[model samples]
Target: MDRYGDSTQKPRVHKAEVMDEISSWDYVIVGTGPAAAEAAVAIRELDNRGKLLMLGAERQLPYQRPPLSKGLWTGKDTVEELPLRSAAEWDGLSVQIHLGDAVIELDAGARTLTSASGRIYRYERLLLATGGRARQPELAIATLRDRVFTLRNFQDYERLQAAARPGLTVLVVGGGFLGAELAAALSRQEGLKVHHAFAGNAPLAHVLPPTLQKVVLARYGKAGVQLHPQHRLEGLDWEDGSVRAHFTTQAPIACDLLVYALGMESNLELAQQAGLTLDKGGVLVNTELRSSDSRIWAAGDLATYPDPVWQEPCRLEHWDNAEATGRAAGRAMAGRSEPFRHQSLFFSDLFELGFEAVGRCDSQRVLRVAAPPGGGKAVVYYGDGDWVEGVLLWNVWGKADAAREGIAAHRPLMDLHWVETLET
Candidate 1:
């Protein structure tokens, strides 16, 4: 039995039938990530009798992705416990799941989808929750594919885990959320050396302020992880079962395994083929999470919906956004129309430091740090002039709701009295 459950014990998954025998469904969902899974559950809550079908490219079921980088290494979570819902629960919901069968074509006019296996599925309403893929750097070391890996899905995690050994030196490329968390996690493993290299001066430089970036760098350094900041990866050279990474400004570092956490690229090929309106590399959707076509809806990382707080079209790749948007889109598809007004928050756990932040936490915005007089934990607000556009609680807990309220209020930073009341 694998982590996903017994391979011999199959659940209520639908196998590919004949192409001529068109299967009709009331709601057809593409992609089987958290977004698609939550959408199915939400739809069942409203209309239980509606025929729902979920198609996924991956072989495994929907599972929590954050644990792949955070909890898996800390011994806090196991791979068997990562699933969003069990097979029995999915069977009870009557949500027909079809794994390892990707939808290659979408006919919006005909309201049908063509799977890779050439089976046509007709639907009254469609939800595209096709999430993003890990962005890989264009390197000349394409021939050394086995030496490189990206942590996106469970399969990737399994491959990386199998390759990792006690004496192996692993080089983690990219300093975004994924890279930072992965470097921190891998460093905790005994007898393994971790090296983190990124283009920015510090980890999460694009999101965290300069002060916080320094703090994170210090934390990673304290954890015995080698840091290569402001280094642009130019090429790679394979040498006797090991790979040497060449950077523009730094010396080459040799490692047995390399993992790229460069971030994600939204999967937009299906939406583009369907002629959907796209913005900022994602499918454009309204406040109700509906696409240009009323019968089609988009959610999760691929859906660029109008953000009420940011007052602009934005797409989030966080787990919370996936669940919230998916639930809202499902309700709308089930004939319960309501605007997706829920404010989403994204949290990260990195080597004893954790934070839950709402709204835009961009580093470019004017930042105001409100800490105690002694300076332990703090609340950082980001905006221009008087309006509060984003908030970050550094090592602070139980203040995500207050942060959301402050951003939604769009008032001056001084008027947010709750910021001062936040304790360490």
Candidate 2:
């Protein structure tokens, strides 16, 4: 079963029709996420007369995804506020939308797409903002599939919320953003015992430096989260009504529910089927977010575009990246093409600690931490040799633009003394 618990059975094929004004769209976007929604709005703003159609596999309308893991649990935001744009707003743009139908086949040369419902539509311009699905473990068994959940969409959030009742033992796997945030959120529940298991010694070990990692781990502990560091999940077994999670080095732990946040695998099957240029990250796109086929474009988590700062193609799965790339791709499709130069920043809230970071904030790189003499908010600079690569504002606010500019400058660490000043 797919994420929605729907069978993967192929739908009956329907005959393809000759391209006509009725069946052809000036722009066809295949997604309902923020990327696709933003692209639609941008297209309508520039080319109001264009026939635009958006196809979404999900039944619900496009909604902001971050709140599913962050604000919803903390009562800062509600499900009612998740919609990116209401149905009336989309209708006002004259954008045709088809939900619960996914594009299963793509013919780039023909500029045609076949949906799972067997309907084929021709497009003058196509945007593949297919986004991604949650990555689950290899050892997940079929018998306990229902109990093993992966939170990606609103439906998954609903299911997980229903299962995460008071007094239930929940084992959240992975230490990445989603895992850490989910663990923190669930722990805040009145009586839920949340166990965070990951391969890293501390949460966000791959991104945050050792200092911030220690701070995050301590915060989670203080929030009543049971930390299972270095516990690489090996397998799972069904024990009565509970699920037993077996780790590589640690003893098996039983939990009432298991949720995996092992990161996302981009929906590249459509891109691959279309024979578009791809890298290990995602579909290769130029600065303007155009794929190998000039008529086709990609955005959001699936577009691995050239980074102006890193000077390398990077696939960023963050909200800012999605919105910026989607808008850029839409404008490009609308004949207002411009090289996308936005340096996307990502932020996360764990308990009371909040952070905003830009560029390649990898922990493996040389890191320099700048904090006040009294010890409060700090800034962490990641660099390679003499040049700065990324910056993290720990509990620091209103400096994301400065951080992005710093990364884009590609200046030596010695010359970028202004980074420390941002801490103030």
Candidate 3:
């Protein structure tokens, strides 16, 4: 046996011996959400020689969550229509897909990961786009069968769609974006009674100021959406599978279904176990989206990184932020130095009205805004008496372009005469 090889003489090795080992990709993305999918493609495009593997928890191909709130629920788009890429497309790109199994643990020191199915993957660099999960409130009726539902994924959306039919009484628990959209969707269905409960005076009250909140509430009211402001849900009493929702404020309201849209918590268990630092609930990443563990990077809702445009720490759960952050994280993983700073672009539709915004809404600012000509308008929100903190619009498409550009350039909205001209 040749236990010892010559120090000076080179040892001959068969080509088969070197080629027998499977080559792990340079990058291993822990999720297949909007950010993960985008990151994978960007990585491939940036360096063609580098291998790419996208790990997803869901069985289905990567898809967008926005459509779950709008198109899918409304029956305007099918599940297939919202996928990140079709089977053929992913196959053509040579990007490996691992669906239906989540990464159970992360070993940063060893640069390896263990999946739920017991598969092990080693990577030179890892990206966490794990996203977040919906937070469900503790309500008694929520335990009952067919009485409560939380719209988080495709399965949840399908259940919600089936439950949101005519003559159904739905009590939406939260006045935030998801709650507002759900209420609007349920109200549009014939004979469906939708009552939305908010802990504040108006919908998104805490996030938006009194004036904008009032307008949002008013719009919801006009759309046959019942608003219960300043009230909290006590519990629910079930009778014959029906629910009587008890509130802290006035009276008990009988409803068939309850939906909670309070907020979301990032899936950072893997990051935490791997000794990665986190900000709030997400993995804390640097300007280049690198985590405390230099071998790892994070993006999407699971990442709490610095926002260059906002000039502060900001975490965005919007679709645009997901896409941008994913691209930035991918590039960063590839050793690029570009900053991952982003504009907080957001959009939503409640029945006939469409709303979009860029930057954080300056709830306290009073910017003179013009009415949308002949029907639609985009309202720019200001903060610090100068900066354009946010923009909100109704029935306005492409208006986000200006707000996005202005925020990216760090320009103050006050300099624009359009704002002063509308004041008088």
- Models 1 onward score TM values of 0.94, 0.92, 0.87
Distance (Å) between predicted and true CA of 243, model 1? 1.5
Q: lDDT per residue, candidate 3, 11-106, as tens digits?
A: 222111222233466889998898998888888777877877887776666777877777665677676676778766876766777766788988
Error of 1 at 129 (Å): 0.3
Q: Residue 413's C-alpha lDDT in candidate 2?
A: 70
Error of 1 at 147 (Å): 0.8
Pairs that collide, model 3: none
- Alpha-carbon runs more than 4 Å astray in model 2: 1-22, 138-142
User: What tens-digit string does per-residue lDDT give for candidate 2 at 1-424?
Assistant: 1233343454321122233343889999999898898899999989999989888888667888998888999899987788887777877888888777788999888888988766789999999999999987765466677778899998799889888889889999999999988999998899999999999989889888887788888888888899999989888998877899999988998998899888899999889988999975699999999999899999999999998766688898999999999999999999998989999999988888889998888899946888777655788888778778888898899999888887787766786466555666
Question: Cα lDDT for residue 262, model 2?
Answer: 87
Local distance difference test values of all predictions, in order: 0.85, 0.85, 0.74
**Model 1 compared with the native: what TM-score?**
0.94
The C-alpha local distance difference test score for the whole of candidate 1 amounts to 0.85
lDDT of 1 by residue, 71-138 (tens): 99888899888988887788889888887678999988888899876778999999999999998766
Where does candidate 1 clash, by residue pair?
A: none
Q: Relative to the unseen true structure, what is the Cα RMSD of model 2?
A: 4.1
